[model samples]
Target chain A: MKTVAGIDIGNSTTEVCIGAFDDRGKLNFLSSASTRTTGTKGTPDNVRGIRTALEAAVQKTGTPRVYPEILLLNEAAPVIGDTAMETITETIIMESSMIGHNPSTPAGVGQAVGEIIGIEHLSQAIQGRDYIVTVPERISYEAAAELLNAVQGMVSVTGAILQRDEAVLVYNRLRRKIPILDEVAKLSQIPEHKQAAVEVALPGQTIHMLSNPYGIATLLNLDAEETRQVMPIAKSLIGKRSAVVIKTPGGNVRENVLPAGEIYISGDSEQTVSIDAGAESIMAAVHEAGTVRDIAGQENSNVGHMLRRIKGGMKNVSGQAESSIRITDILAVDTLAPVQISGALAGETCMEKAVGVAAMVKTSQLPMREIADRLQAELGIEVRVAGVEAVMASMGAMTTPGTKLPLAILDMGGGSTDAALVTEEGRVAVTHQAGAGELVTMLIQTELGLHSRITAERIKRYPLAKVESLFHIRLESGEIRFFEEPLSPRFFGSVVLLEPEEMVRIEEDLTLEQIVDVRRGAKKKVFITNALRALEIVAPEHNLRRVPNVVLVGGSAEDFEIPEMLLEELANYRVLCGRGNIRRTEGPRNAVATGLVMSWWSE
Target chain B: MQTNKPAVHLYTVDETLPAIREICAGMEEEGVPWKILRMDGTARGLAYRAATDSVLESGIGLTAGEVALQMRKVAEDRPLFVFADPTAEQYRMIGANAARAVKKKRFVTVQAG
Candidate 1:
């Protein structure tokens, strides 16, 4: 009997399959283990993680970390850019005066035009001159209401911008109703003596005057040239219930598209596409240049810098030559990332269009022999670097009880999408494409304007809920879940990611529907697009209709929604596909490792 | 027990906690008219009665040791929040939350003083 271990060191994890085979070559699986990959895959740094996985399976009470007689490792596919996701466009706001805030409640319902005056300066205001008083945070609601009531008789108090959430409190005390905007966090930054227009829509409605450029022109009496300059401000405030646009000198909201530069894709012919042309045009150019030979970008441009930086990072970690690194595939998808509006009173953010790119890179080979040699020397065992990622994956996929030959295995991983087809005639075909879980995460992050990737990842992986009340939450499915114990107030009135342990609040200014739409849309864009493309590349004649069974295997394959989404889309082509169950035990995971051990029987 | 007058009911443990005045002022400042009533019970129990008895279906219950805010027909054990040894700021929030419930507005985040 020979005891062999199969180690699949992936971008995110290192998985090991330990099993024994008899003289007749029938394999019996003994145990398996998985650990977080310590470093970039296909490097000597992966040796520690390999040994850790082996130690987990071989550790038996005091028996000094035993090693398997034969160790086989799957060749890990590395995606360029050390990290796969990159945003091609960045938004820069210059000399802007835009405050786009969505405070849940603002008092009154009308448009008011006046010169803004701070509460401290209200006492010295001239009579008959219209003024919009700005209330700071120190003044209590009662104090502000009393002061506004007292001062209404003196100056023409047309409106008010408040630092605290006391708009309703102050509005109720006024004898005459006027529009009021509250919860202005950066009230001090607002020019005190500038001409401003405050508009508050009725309940269940959005502002009309401030959100429209002509409405602002009529309210603030701006000329045609000045009115055109504030177009971005009006466009940003369209759906807000209340908005305040102050005319600060030289304050202009200009949407500048930072030069993202052009990407040069070379196959049989060279194709050049501008990043600013957006994802669709860039993708068309990519498709035209089939089998990308070596991609380049305009020198010193954003795309160029990004490609070179990614190449540099990969070289540092993999010790591969800069000239040797080859960009095989690039997936570009249109995305929107939130950019802070300059001179915004409330740290308002606008979602700006960006191009999210993920590229697949192969360095001749990532020197898996170095990892194998190191593991062999340290463990004093025979370690052989064996099996391509897709081959190992398909061999492991066959362990599924009812699965048969002529099957296609889809390994949806973090950085790359890979597919392999094992024909009934014993022929094998494999292909790798860029964009996977990492790209999906980038889309979610950019579209929702989530500051952290972890938050975006949680939103991508789990279900969401809108905390309608303290005790109840309306799930994305429209079912209301009631908690017996009062939930923490932090989640109140916010969209939260329903993780296994707790409800994590998504702090961005977004509705539940918007978040869900972005998440589902991102998944569809990445997985559906890559799944079809990968299938076509590996299928006979590149015709998906000719393909038969497709088994999904990888970390991303375990996503709660992506499998159903991929299956639903694949139904059109009449291809039978679902998330793979490796050995009917591991749910859509450990495929490469399991297949490595199974490769022994094939030999 | 008439539900005609829509006022956020305030039920306090003792007649003079001094914090009750601030709570009443909070609701009044928010422009929602309120009526104060004295009751002796646990904050949760008093909040339940206050919410059930009021026309607006919103209530704030205060005991010497804790403060609780409730809305009628919600889970009795789970009032919006129950604070132990709540400070003056929290008492004001209790009033604001009850008024917000009546106004169909978002409840202000409650913080202990």
Candidate 2:
């Protein structure tokens, strides 16, 4: 008999299968064994573990006499990590206190007047006859109050047109309880002689007047054309809280204001400045800087302020003498609110966080080459690492006996899942994904809070049976049956007493059902998700609906339930899924090794 | 039929096409009914195509061993030939012989012209 050895090095374990070919060229399974893979399974450092597994299989098979005619070698499929990093930065500039004037028509020009809450306005009267104007979305209620207070007058603050939930908090802090409108959608532009009320809509709710045309027309006293013109404003109030409208003569008119050129800076600065000097512009500039300064000065600020402080705090490292600093970039926004500025330094500090994240995801391929060299030096063997997908395809073809043609294979490993499609045209395509069995283990560990990975793996692999009564356990192959075996103390109440000697334990505290649920859910989220993604990416031009049969291999396929799970998952596409026949014919776990031997044919 | 005494031979060339021609000429002189197969568009296009198709129709019935013999004949000139591709139905026919030759160190020399 001519003996051939097949070896598979996996992330968690190394498997070996020894098969012998008779004189008639018929292949027969001899022996198979598995051992824990040491070091990195995907690296050349794993040769020691592979050697151990091969030795064990050889010992079990007792094929020493035939070793001369037999082949002894392991297949090397290198593991390389691929990662992608992306950074998205968005900046929004705001102008403060200035009215965004769109003067296509004149009745919309007047400033909105409302009662001052925390601060008085400049146009305050003894009787407090102020025009109840709507506030734009850009300005917060607190800033509105501050703007009014700085105007220097005994203005009775009643309500404001605010942007966010902080409106209620600002209102709560007022000395007097006034009618507050939270979401005023279009506060900057109000129609004339239109008696409209501002109302702050609750979260997840749209303002009544804004959603309905009739409501807006009734509140604003608009005719057909005017109502039609203001319909968009009504639509914009779909999710606002407070709004304000004024009763003006000659109907409402919209105005357009040209924006001045924007200022772009690449350094640090002390205060906000504007190219065109005007009361509104100056007020907006001051408001932007003042608000930022106050927040920075406060004991506890919001996340935005905290981020700014963190950036600013890193200005002078190592006590180097402080040099000239300028604002990095300034973007101008066409709003009455203050502009927001973002700064970045010239050195590594500016991009340190982003670079760190990118580095973590970008696992380099350099280590793989080094590992290959090391393995060659340690063991007198040539190790060539390749994508798992390629290896799976080769193995799939070898294991499927008498099946002549192009076939695809999917190898689901612990850390990654790979698939390779070989076409009848002799072309091959392969793809690899990051999440697989490891993710399932993670889910099981997290859900059960199991401290040990071994325990988690056990839960993932086996089914549970409760021992109703103590009984004997029997095995047909080994003829090693036991009776009247003493049960462990831990299996007392929860276990079903099967027999006097043997007790069947049902996992009550941590059951396989829970593990299956978590495992399947995680697989759906990771493997299945990645599978579809990889398939689409690999077969971009090919119609996936018409793809051929797929064979499954690897340790994951050894699980009794995994095949069924995959079959059900892939049922929609009418794809065929089954365990590789390698084990039945040549012993399981030798598919790759067999393929390695067979690879000599194609080389 | 009477035959002359057999003799072993080895030929090398700097380029792929010339090496392929020299090997083909040697095979013809040796009276070996061999075929050549090309995978994809690599190597000498005209020669590889002509060799592969002729061998397929060589009346030897598409067997892996037969294909390997053809490949071995061609390999005397072109070193690189794909014999086993899982996706192809004819992989088995060519793969068996190529594998044997590779093991015996009789396959085409990769770096030798």
iRMSD of all candidate structures = 4.0, 38.6
Q: Model 1, stretches more than 4 Å misplaced?
A: A58-68, A78-98, A118-130, A138-155, A192-194, A247-249, A297-305, A467-472, A480-494, B1-8, B13-34, B40-91, B97-113
On DockQ, the candidate that comes out on top is 1
Worst lDDT run of 10 residues, candidate 1 chain B, spans B104-113
Per-residue lDDT of model 1, residues A419-536, tens digit only: 9999999799988888899989988888887789999899999999888766789999999999886676566677888999988988766788898899999999998999998999
lDDT of 2 at A579: 64
Q: In candidate 1, which residue pairs get closer than 3 Å at backbone N, Cα or C atoms, i.e. clash? A: none
The most accurate candidate by lDDT is 1
Compute the TM-score of each model's chain A versus the native chain A and list the values.
0.90, 0.45
lDDT of 2 at A537: 40
Minimal lDDT window, size 10, model 1 chain A: A81-90
Per-residue lDDT of candidate 2, residues A1-603 (tens digit): 656655566667776656676676666666777888877544545668867876777678764532313333443333322111111122211111111111111111112344322222234333444434344555544565456454424554344434332343344444544444433233333332233344444443444654566666675566887677555344433443334443334333222222222221122234534323332453254334521212111223222232233223222211222131112111111112111112110000111000000000012122344555665576555555433436544553456653434666667666566677776776778765545665565545544545676655665665443322123222212233333643332342232213335444434243334545655665555556545544554452755555566667766766656767777777777766666776446423456766644443333
Distance from true location, Cα of A175 in model 1, Å: 1.0
Candidate 2: C-alpha lDDT: 0.41
